[model samples]
Target: MKNTIIIIISILLLVFIFSGCGPEKKKVAVLIYDMEDPFIKGVSEYLKAFDQKSYDITYYDSQKSQIVQNKIAEKLYKEGVDLLVINPVERLSSYIFVKKSLQEEIPIIFFNREPLKEDLEYFEDVYYVGTDARESGMMQAKLISEGLGNDTENLGGFDKNGDHIIQCVILKGEQGHQDAEERTKSVIEGLKGEGFKVEVLHTKVANWNETKAYRAMHEIMSEFGEDIELLISNNDAMAIGASKYLMDNGYFGMEVDGVVTDIPFRIVGIDGLEEAKLLTKKGYMYGTIINDGKSMAEAIMQLSEYILENDEEKLQYELVDNKYILISYKYHSNE
Candidate 1:
């Protein structure tokens, strides 16, 4: 009887040990700058829907505050998360998180809002996954030039005053955001490079908010009236907002019997959101550049997997400079 009882106890111990040895899920913490931003919200939703069997992922919103982001980072760090994917509120403040990540020996993947190059170089394990800002701006210019018939002499009837110069209004994303600055600057440069004469009527800083862009459009239209020939926006949300204002005031087209009519002025933006694509197809908006959020989410997850497994082969996206993964942007228009 004693021998039988000893054998039973040994078998139970063996079973317990085997069960405990099963693969454990890696804890991943994703920190987003603002949940309200449409682009960021789309990216977050993609991250949330990733395969959950191997990773235990959680999301934190910074509420557009660097201070709030810092606090959330600290809390996540204390909780012993294995990895961090952050879209920083303030690009410069990335250094703070980098230092902490280095000290804690945790890998980080910064996406969307890129950090300073110097900060990214501080750690070997740190990585950035995002689309090129300048590329998006250049694409925006291409769409605009094409929409206007690529004619310097006539501007495809878009030159309302027949001055051969496009009178434009710009809706800027944010004050100091790198993407915003780069996109705004590159678009203007690109147009000039294409041998098109452009005159900016007014530029309003909308901070990437649709409501703010709506209000800014109102103010701009009030000041400039019909002299505004083209509207350029840094993102689709703002473009959509501006389009709404234009439609309400009879500037944009109204659909009648499933056909949009009475369209005036050309409008273009970056970030190829679904609504923007539909609008472009229906001739409500000119064009947009695809930011490709789904691809970004996949890249971030692959990087996270590579970090957890310590296998570079796990990365599917081409990592440039051993630190960055740049996703390409494509121009979308009604072709």
Candidate 2:
């Protein structure tokens, strides 16, 4: 009977040891700007597929509202989440969410849309993962310059009119958006540096919505007709929208006596998404600058691991002051 009791106690001790040795599942909450944005959609998909061995992830969609984002963030904090990942709907309004999370001592990783610098400085545990907007803009101009045959005087082939000036239309994203403003200004500056005398026919704000881009492009086409030699969009969605309108109106890919006479106009965009890459491969889009979503995901995971382990030395990348993990841009060719 004593020997039986010893065996039972040993079994109980073994059970207790195993139960205590099991790793605690870290609770991670992710807040997205909107699942509607394809780039953010891709990132959210990746985050969802993250290894369950390390984290239990819960996702929340802000639906592009600051109030909704703040409310969801507060709820996540109250739930005792170990980490918070956010892609703010409106960057300028991200302070509310960041402040709340920081005050609660929860580590936050801000992806895609960047919060203000002051918000990040409030806590060392905060980080931002995104690319430099100016790089994409410069890349778009390089593609345009290359398409013009790299001849400063000739403006590549963009100067379809013999007038020696390139007439271009800008399909801008959101009006007050940081990406839109930087891309718009940098592309023009880059083009000027490439020795092209550019004449801006019109600049229209499409709010980064495809439907709005379609409507705006249609009107611009009606006014400019074939006189518009180039089209520069802040993102691939807008470029695709404008391209769709042009294709539907028989302005592009016209057949002349059984021969496909494609329009000579070049269209450049940012964000080398899969759809955009496919379009580029089909010669519909001129080219695009890659916004690396995978890199952003990797960075977020690395930062989260650093926070959880409390070992900055184990981090894959040292968090730079200001902590901007700017992903590099790759130019996707339409050729």
Candidate 3:
């Protein structure tokens, strides 16, 4: 009995030592795409609102360049960061970083965008926490369809005419952005399933640049005329670019380029920006879908803490759904 009691005491001492002597201060590296972008600005702004003496957070800007980003990530790995949070620029190019991090045994929390999951699977404990783009796209699609109903003339039960078509010009992000791919696919599928004849006259890749998006909008205007009913930019920045293009060309007939009406068409996008929200209140934009960036930042912080403190098996894929969609028409010129 004495021997068993002594064994228990030894186990208790080891546990106490392990708990008390935990790794001193964790260093985190955030590899992001274009820190200058308002979206990343929101994330970084919130991070600064906390006590940073306990945590070391450094953000590396890829400047939308995968080559530079890969280099930054490798240097961070070489310096031995405890955790790495990456907002990958390219879908497949991110394997360069993910593959290297695997050999290092560092945990990663991917937010907003994702690298290839198959490539990410090599890591010991990696968490995929962010929005569900496909579902969000579907939600945007459902709203657009309802807006079309407002456009469609009620032919009445006797007339039987469900043949209302919506002319749309899509502004896609860089070639392989998951947001551009999944969102465009979901929105298109949603419209197709509803028997809506959406003629996609112009689908241009903007690379998520405001100027590039503006230039693309100019070209779209030449081809489809300024009367294009619905403008679906993959994000708010691109949507604003299209709106600016319209305003510059003096096409104020129906500054309706939101999730509202497509005739004087409404404009629509995700990642609801503050300007977009205020515009909704001021009758500038028809509506926007809010991604809740502050919520994402808070989640990133909490999840990072949980991973460090708890030794539970992490998830294979976590769809941390910020499935919140806000459709407003306060910006409608007619309203």
Candidate 4:
């Protein structure tokens, strides 16, 4: 009887050990700057759709406030998350989060918005996955030049006044955002470098908001009117808003077989959103640069897995300087 009892006890202990050895999900905390931003929304959706079997993911929205993001970062650190993925509210404040990650010993991946190079180099565990903002800006200029027939001296019919210079109105993003600043500066410089003369009629800060862009467009049109030959927006949302304003005011007239037959001026933007693609197809907007959010999410997940496993050999994406993963931008146009 003693031998039989010993056998039963040993078998129960073996079963318990095996059951507890099943693969455990890693906890990941994803903090988004703002869910309302269309580009950020797309990235978050892609992250959410990832397979949940390997990761227990929780998300927090910062509502476009840096203070709120800092609080959430603190809470998640205390809660002991294995990984923290942040799309920061402000790029300048990235050091705060980096310091927090170092103190808490949590690995961090920043996407969409990039952190300062110094902050990213502050820790070995810090990683960034994003596109080069300057590349997006250059592509925007290429699209505009192509639409104007690629001739600096004789900008074709779209020139409106045959002045050999593109009269443009720019709809800028946030005041101090890195991407906004880079995109705004690079596009203009890119145009000049390509030997195209560009006269910026007006530049307004639309804050990457569609409604604000619509209002800005209204004001711009009220002043510049037909003298404006081109519209350049920092993002697709603003471009779409400007297009809407144009349509409402009889700028784009009479759709013939689902295509706008009369488009007054060429409008271009970054971020190849679906709505922007539809607008481009219908001739309301000219072109856009593809931001490629889906691939960014995949890269972030792969990096997370690599960090969690402590295996650099398994990393699929090439890390530039062991710090950044840059996704390339592609230009998309109707032609």
Candidate 5:
């Protein structure tokens, strides 16, 4: 009995020692460009929910400034972070981040806003997680064109002006943003491919802000008025902004039954946020393409684990060609 009691005490002591001396928890630094963005906010929440508890994640909001982002990154490195997940303020300005990652031998997962492909190819320790911006645009066009009923010849519903051409006003995101450029260009191209001759009344760069989008829509309404048949935005925030303005001006309104009615102009946007989905369900917005925040968060976490653990099999399954893990968008329509 004495020997068994001694054995139990020894086992308890060993457990305490090992628990106290186990390897330090890995630290992950996540730098987001703007925390106020709805889709990004959703992604952050998902990341928190899906964390595996093996590592500690710290999120820093750069507030849409490259200098701030750089400083935050430096601070994180000084604090001994094991990995970085960056949604850059400027995609092309990733050189500084890349250099730091190389110097410190830390892995980086560039999600959402992507750096150039050439820049990505420059390092083996870096990866990008995002959907093809053009795909969102294609889906937007598909929703719009399909709603018009005719695939090619008749552009009846969309060409609300009774002319053969559809008058469109584009609410673009940040001016040099890659996603903005691609989404804007591809949507136009997709429309043309569907035989809808587009007359772009104006292209307003709203910097992805709902307030800016509201102001831009107000100004555009002053100039173009009802001549604009379709409002296409790079994100749902801008669409919401436009919708609010339309609601104030009698172009859109909620009926007695709580359904969104009186939507005269067909409106569309990307990034199917919950609020946007709710609006779509109410028949306010025509449609939106859902950016899968859950999938993105899962991929980021999986890749982070693979990097810190050096698990090549996990890495292989997480990425395609050891570089990009592109998520696909799902379409949601209220039409």
Candidate 6:
């Protein structure tokens, strides 16, 4: 009877140990400007795939207010989250949240966009995972420069060296957003390198709003009339705004056919949205590169796991592009 009791006790002890060996639970927070944005959609989708893992994702959206985003970050930090993934609204203003997270000793990963590198370099704990913004912009510029030969004969535009010297109306994003600033800078530099400098007739701030884009494009239409040869928007929404102006001014019909109809004369922008892709495919606009946001999130997830198991002192500051993904129908239709 004593031997039977010992066996039962041993079974209970084994059950206790095995039950205690379940996976460690992790709680993470994801902060973004808005969920409607494609970048956020991609990140959320990526996070959902890992539901079987021992993790929780709390979402916070700033609804286009820097102060609100800052508040959300602070709240998440105070909640003692194991990790924070952010798509910041502004570069400098959001650093205070970074400071708070660092003070609390939680790991951070800036998603889709990065903080100011100058500030980030000082904070050794923050990790950023996204496309190389400058390189992405440069790729767009190279496509435009190469299309110069195609631009003039079709659009009655002037040529400079091997590229076209088209008058550009630029609708840039917020001034303090690092991605916007870097993308604009890189595209301009790339264009200059091709021996054809785009004369920026106006560089207005759209703040990543469709309404702002529409308003700015309207102003550009009234200011330059039809003299604006091209619109190089920083985002697809702004590019669609520029296209609205073209449509409003009756620039898409028979009159555009003779002197400047053959060359594509609409707004060219990024993010590879469905509308952007459709327009580019139909010869209404030039499409852009599609950064694989899902792959980026997965890589970040792996990196975090590696760090949790390995030496934290050996943390590497890294940049990754899983592939050179350009989604232009004219160019990379295979993608």
- TM-score for each model: 0.94, 0.89, 0.77, 0.93, 0.91, 0.77
> Candidate 3: which stretches are off by over 4 Å?
1-23, 50-52, 150-163, 253-263, 311-335
Candidate 4 per-residue C-alpha lDDT over 214-288 given as tens digits, one digit per residue, 9 for 90 to 100: 988878988997898889999999999999999888988798887899887899999889999999998899899
lDDT of 1 by residue, 220-316 (tens): 9889867988899999999999988887888756687654676778889888899888888888888899999988988998888888998989898
Error of 3 at 273 (Å): 0.5
Looking at model 1, residue 210 earns an lDDT score of 83
lDDT of 3 by residue, 109-224 (tens): 77677666676566656766567777667767766655555333331111122345666778897666777888899988887776666778788998766678888876788888
Go through the candidates in order and give the C-alpha RMSD of each one to the true structure: 1.9, 3.1, 9.2, 2.3, 3.1, 5.9
* lDDT (C-alpha, whole model) for all candidates: 0.89, 0.81, 0.67, 0.90, 0.85, 0.65
Pairs with backbone N, CA or C atoms under 3 Å apart (clashes), candidate 4: none
lDDT of 2 by residue, 1-335 (tens): 99999999999999998988867788888888888877778877776565445777778988978789888887777778888888887888767766776678888888888788898887777888887888888888889888777776656666667788889999998888888999999999998988888899999998777678888987898898678888999988888888788778777675565433687588888877787787677677778888877777777776777778786764676466747677788878855
Q: Write one digit per residue (lDDT tens) for candidate 5, span 275-296.
A: 7778777777888989898999
Query: lDDT of candidate 3?
Result: 0.67
- Please report how far candidate 4 places residue 118 from its true position, in Å: 0.8
In candidate 6 the C-alpha lDDT for residue 47 amounts to 64
User: What clash pairs does model 2 have?
Assistant: 148-156, 148-157
Clashing pairs in 5: none
Considering lDDT, which of the candidate structures 5 and 6 is the better prediction for this target? 5
> What tens digits encode model 6's per-residue C-alpha lDDT throughout 200-253?
878889876556787776677788755666677777767666665565666665
Two-way TM-score contest, 1 vs 5, winner: 1
Q: Which predicted model would earn the best TM-score? A: 1
Report lDDT (Cα) of residue 308, candidate 3: 68
Candidate 1: misplaced stretches above 4 Å? 1-21
